[model samples]
Target: MQRQTLRLLSSTASIVFSVLATQASAQMFNSVQLHAAAPGQSGGMLGVAALSTPEYQGSAKNRKLIVPVVDYQWANGWFAGGSNGLGYNFSGDPKFHYGVRMTGDIGRKEKRAKLLRGLGDIDAKPEIGAFFTFNPGADTYFASSVRYGAGNDNKGMLFDLSAGFTESWNRNLSAGASLGASYANDNYMQSFFGISQVQSARSSHKIYTPKAGLKNTYVSAFVSYMINDRTSLSLIVTSDRLAGDAKSSPLSEKTRTSSIVAAAAYHF
Candidate 1:
């Protein structure tokens, strides 16, 4: 019983440690990494996260949000909660993971800033994607994913690639860093960064059209600490720089964005 309990608690901490980052990163931790609880045991992390993120992918404006966290996965490799979205893991490899899921983005809203006054709202759209991840060692991992059906007409697409490493300083602490980039389709680029003729006439910005290319590159670092058997704390910082056509959008006031996240999670 004690062994199972420890496993359950450890599983909770593992999930908590990666939750917020995965929420913002559009990646999913493998089942072996996430569902570590003992057979028939239930230990999922739930908490709150505070974030300061760009209004849009390349927006210079930042917005703050506080949201609740909820996640629990069963033994069958199916789970749903918060930002990781609903998904199922079919891979049984301890070092490799692959799956399909539904993910989406909150499209830009004109009310987000005066700079967007002339640009109309880009309605949020649903996206479906497949993901693959490989853990070559206990401390290193590589992940990639492609999402489609984005944009107003569902013609946009996104591809994400990242690599990372984590070091466990002690039973109670772990730290890691990641480097990644995002690629977008022409439709996706235009949907968010392109300015239409009507928009140019209505807003202060001039008409501009963007092409599909690498949208941004980012670096992230994070540290997590277990406060107790059932609780954990984490802090993550990320900085993103717009690249290719994404950097030259006339609608963009800044080509770089940095964000911070802090949270505490508990297993119940």
Candidate 2:
């Protein structure tokens, strides 16, 4: 269980924005997820965390949030909670997992900041997707996932890919780092980065339409300390840079930014 606890730290070391997802669209996450726990060794976590993020994806503003942290898995491979969403673990191999999941997007709201005056609200949407993860060694992991059903028409799609490495300095101190990328489809790009003519007329910016392509690249690192078997404390830092369409879009204010997060989690 101590080893499993450290794995969780590697999985979330790079989240800079929200308590739930790594990326803004469809609640995308780092390559490693909450599904890699040893099978039948089911356990759960309950905690709270604070998030510091840009007012929107590209705005030059920031906002803070207090979010709940909850995650759990059953002995039968069924899991639910923050990054895991509600998914089933089907991989027969103990070193990896592949399954389907239901996740959601916390769409952007224009009213969140003054910079978004003309842009309309983007309604949150439920999503369906697949996840695949592989651990080549006890300390190395590769992960990828794709989700659909975001945006106003619910036709947006996003693909996230990542890899991670972990280490244990001692029985009570652990650390990990990860690298990842994100891709957006036409609908998803247009909804968030592109502005229509009608929208241009209403907003401060001109009409700009961006095609689908690579959206961002990021890296994350973390250090965690175990207070005891059931409790742990962590400090996570993540940095991301916009690329391709997301970078060229007029909506992008700061192309590169970083996030810092601290949390305490308990295992049961």
Candidate 3:
């Protein structure tokens, strides 16, 4: 079973803890001026938010979900949480970092949408990858990551490249924006966008095969306001467009989708 509700709840708890830990650490150590200049919070932070995203790649329908955002970093570089999962920061310089990590692959479940019918469900699995970040200057960075599925459910490889900029407008207000793109291997394309003979027979769609190619591109922005040192509120907006074979798949309902997320994080 997917245990979607349980997963969301657990993730929420993790994000809350991370938020509190990070906020508390900052207030305890940094001066007010220094805090305002920082790019991101330190230590663990937890956040809870409602997210709206496509029910599946190419689907026009959207699903609103509650998610917990969690991130943590240790002095020695070993840490876990967020999309990066468990990893160690190998670079000694603050401007650059690289590390390997393992993250959970939350595959698609057919129950979420009608378009997924006849396409066999993909199981939750694991992926291992290496990530690198380069900070060109204060509040700006470029990053890339590549991962390969280590599980049977979706044994595919993916690569992502992105650029982001963050700024603190005032002591209590900060914002960031990012643009990114992704590439998927044949396995990934086939699993999510390809139509098997059985699926074609079962559904009203024709059999189709998608090859390896660019998958999607997206742009996102976020703003956060600190209510106090221990708590904050944030809103995020994102828009994405399916490309290559993914856009042509009969399984895909729309070429573009948008999402908004609102959340609060508490630091202890």
Candidate 1: minimum summed lDDT over ten consecutive residues — where? 23-32
- After superposition on all C-alphas, the RMSD of every candidate to the true structure, in Å, is 3.8, 2.3, 9.7
Off by over 4 Å in 1: 1-43
Can you write out model 2's per-residue Cα lDDT over 1-268, one digit (the tens) per residue? Answer: 6566566554334222237253343236434365324556786677667766566776666667677777777778888877567888787675787899887788888898776788899998898988898878666878898889988789988898888787988877888877888899999999888898988999989888888899888887778777877677777777778889889888888898766677777767
Among all candidates shown, the one with the greatest TM-score? 2
Model 3, 161-220: lDDT tens digits are: 777666666666777776778888889888778888988898777999899999888776
Better of 1 and 3 by TM-score: 1
Q: Which regions of candidate 2 fall more than 4 Å away from where they truly are?
A: 1-5, 8-27, 30-32, 35-37
Model-by-model lDDT, in order?
0.67, 0.73, 0.62
State which candidate has the highest lDDT: 2
- Model 3 misplaced regions, further than 4 Å: 1-42, 150-153
Clashes of each: 0, 0, 11
- Of 1 and 2, which scores higher on TM-score? 2
Candidates sorted on TM-score, descending:
2, 1, 3
Candidate 1 at 173: error in angstroms? 1.7
What C-alpha lDDT does candidate 1 achieve relative to the native structure? 0.67
For model 1, state the Cα shift of residue 184 in Å.
0.3
